[model samples]
Structure formats: structure tokens, C-alpha cells
Target: MPDTPTPLIWLAGATGLVGRALLTELGHEQPVLALLRRPDPSLPAQQQQQQQTALVDYAQPASFAALPAPSQVFIALGSTIAQAGSQAAFRAVDFDAVLTVARAARQAGARRCAVVSALGADPRSSVFYNRVKGEAEAALVALGFERLVIARPSLLDGERASLGQPARRGEQWALRLMRPIAGLIPAAWRPIRPERVARAMRLALAQEWAAVQVLESAELQTVGD
Candidate 1:
């Protein structure tokens, strides 16, 4: 009998809060191929050197064609409408880019995938953000992966400034207002750390599943923590 080859994992969005956390969590366990739009100077040199990487423009389909085969993939790409400056621009990243990566990964031989989505996601949601998230989830489900894990986390808690990202005033205000009575809030609605979401994503991918698995914020709190 021959020894089994180690699985190759592909990760998109290597610079976001959850993405960065995923890099640290996944790198130690597998040979990860971190896909980035540009080089991140904020990433520690030692950490950057530990993994394989490919600079890719998600908008360019040709960029993903040369990717090495992957057994699993993780997508943490996201953006707010405010940051994107329009609903269409927001959808470009949250929906189109995300689906593009999943399609490319599937074509590259990936069978397992995990993605970061938001709470209150519903395909029919009137709210643009949640609707887009829901639509992205639906699109991934259609990709026919053996195991698909969608993590729906509440407001993510992380140091955006450290990552060279501008602060979200709404998020900051919500954190401040909730901090004093966090324990009283429902787990499903409570803000969660990006690290916890990343950990949960890793754990979910490690398990065997028939098809799709959805992790809500409450479940993430229990398992991810």
C-alpha cells in the first residue's frame, strides 16, 4: 500500500479579520495555498513564509485556472456596501467573487468547502447584505461539494485598525453598547470573535458530512469557542 498524500487546502481572502485568523489556524494543520489579491505587509514574515501563496485577481477567471488541485477550500471574502460605495459593487465581492472562487475551486478538484456568511441571511431578505449572503450560500450549494459548511456569524469582533482597515462606526458602537450586558444577550445575536469563527470553520471542515452543514452564531459560540 502507498502512503496517502497530504490534502492541499486553498484559502481565499487571506487578509481579512477572519481570513487572517484562518491562515494561522489552518497553516499548522495542512499545506495551505493562500490566495490573495496583493501582498500583505502586515502579515508577519515568518507566517508568510510558512505557506504557499498565489496572487490572483478574482475578477479575472484566468487567474484561477492555473491553481493546483485542492481537496478543500475556505472563502472569507466580504465587504460592506459603505466600503464598496454601492450595492452592485458590494455584490461584486460578496456574491460574484465568492461564487467565482468556489466554481474555480470545484474545477480544481476541491470537494469540501467552508465559507463565512453573516447572521440573518435569507435569500428573500429585503436587506441587501443578508440577501447577498444568502444568495452566495445558495450558489455554493449548487456547486455540489461533498461537504459544504456555511458559518453565519454575528457582528465579528476584531481589530480592523491592526489590519490597516478603516473602523466601522456602527460595529464599534454596537460593541460598546453590548459589552456592558453581553451576558444577557442571546448567543445567536451576540458579537463573536473572528478567531472563534475561524476555529469553527476549521473544525467543521475536518468532520465528515453527507452534504451541507450550516453553523449559526449560537452554535459557533459553543463549538468554535
Candidate 2:
């Protein structure tokens, strides 16, 4: 009898906070193919050797066509309206690009998927950001994956400077104000480390769940911890 082959995992947004942590978590245990907007020469030589990478233009559907099929896929792609420079640009990445990748992965034989979403995601949300996230979630459910894990994490805590990304002033200020009274805040609303979110995503995907499973920030803290 032959030994079973390790599963190949497809990861998008490999440079982002949660994505980076998830990559580290996957380590050398499973083969990984990281799809990125550009080359990241900064990746450690060992990790580079362990993980395959492909540069992709999320706006271009054809970019994902060449990707090899995988059993599982993870999407951490997202951007704030400010970073995107306009609401339309933000939607292009957060909604359109995300669904594009998901649709492509599903076409490539991926049965299980995990996606990072914001805390207040709701399709009917009056807030544009939340509305977009909600719409993405709804659309993913409609894709009919065998197993889907949606992580809704509150204000992600990570070192953006280390990733060569600009700091979000609002997040910085909120962290400062919340730190001293963190225990007083609701667990669901409190700041969560990107690593925790990453862990929760991995753990959730490992389970046998039917249809969709949503992991809230509070549950992420417990399960991820």
C-alpha cells in the first residue's frame, strides 16, 4: 500500500497579517501554493523552498486559470476604503476580487474554504464596508462548497510596519484607548490578534462541518487560544 499524499493548500493574501500567520502555521506539514499580487523576495529561504508562489492579478480572471487544483483554499484578501482610494476600488478588492478567487478555486476542485471577514458584516448593513463584506459572505454561501469557514474577527492586532504597510491611525488610537480596559469590553468586540484569527481558521477548517460555519471573535479567542 502507498502512503497517502499530503494535501495542497491554496492561499491568497500571503503578505497580509492573518495570511502570514496561517502560512507559518501550515509550515512544512502540507504543500502550499501562495497566490500574490507580486513577488515577495523577503520570504525566508526555507519557507520559499517549502511553498510554491504564483503572481496573480486578481482583477484578471485568467490569472487564476493556470493554478493547479487544491483540496482547500484560504482567502485573506481585503482592503480599507482609504487604502483603496475610493469605495469602488475597495469593493473591487474586497468583493469582486474575493469572489473571483473563490469561483476560480471552486472550478479547480477545492471543496473546503476559509475566508476572513470583518466583525459587522451584513448584506443589509447601512455601512458600506460592512455591506460589502456581508455581500461577499452571502455570495460565498451560494457557491455551494462542501465546507465553508467564515471568520469574523474584530479589530485585528498585528504589526503592519513589519509588513511594510502603512499604519491605520484609527486602529492605533483604538488599541491605545482599549488596552487598559480590555477586560471590560465584550469579547466579541475586543481587539483580536491576527495569529489567533489564523489559528481559529485552521482549526475550524480541520473539523467536519456541514455547509457553512461562522466563527465569531469571542469563539475565535477560545478556540484559537
Best-performing candidate as measured by lDDT: 1
Which digits, one per residue and each the tens of the lDDT, describe model 2 over residues 37-124?
Answer: 8898766567887898998999898998988888899999989999899999999999998999899999999999999999999999
Candidate 1 least-lDDT 10 residues: 40-49
Question: Which candidate number maximizes TM-score?
Answer: 1
**Could you tell me the TM-score of candidate 1?**
0.96
Prediction RMSDs, each to the true structure: 1.5, 1.5
Candidate 1, residues 1-225, lDDT tens digits: the string is 999889889999888999999999998998989998988778757776678889888899789888888999999999999989999999999999999899999998999999999999899999989999999999999999999999999988788888998888999899999878889999999989899999999998889865999999999988844
Which residue pairs in candidate 2 have backbone atoms (N, alpha carbon, C) closer than 3 angstroms, thus clashing?
none
TM-score of each: 0.96, 0.95
Off by over 4 Å in 2: 1-5
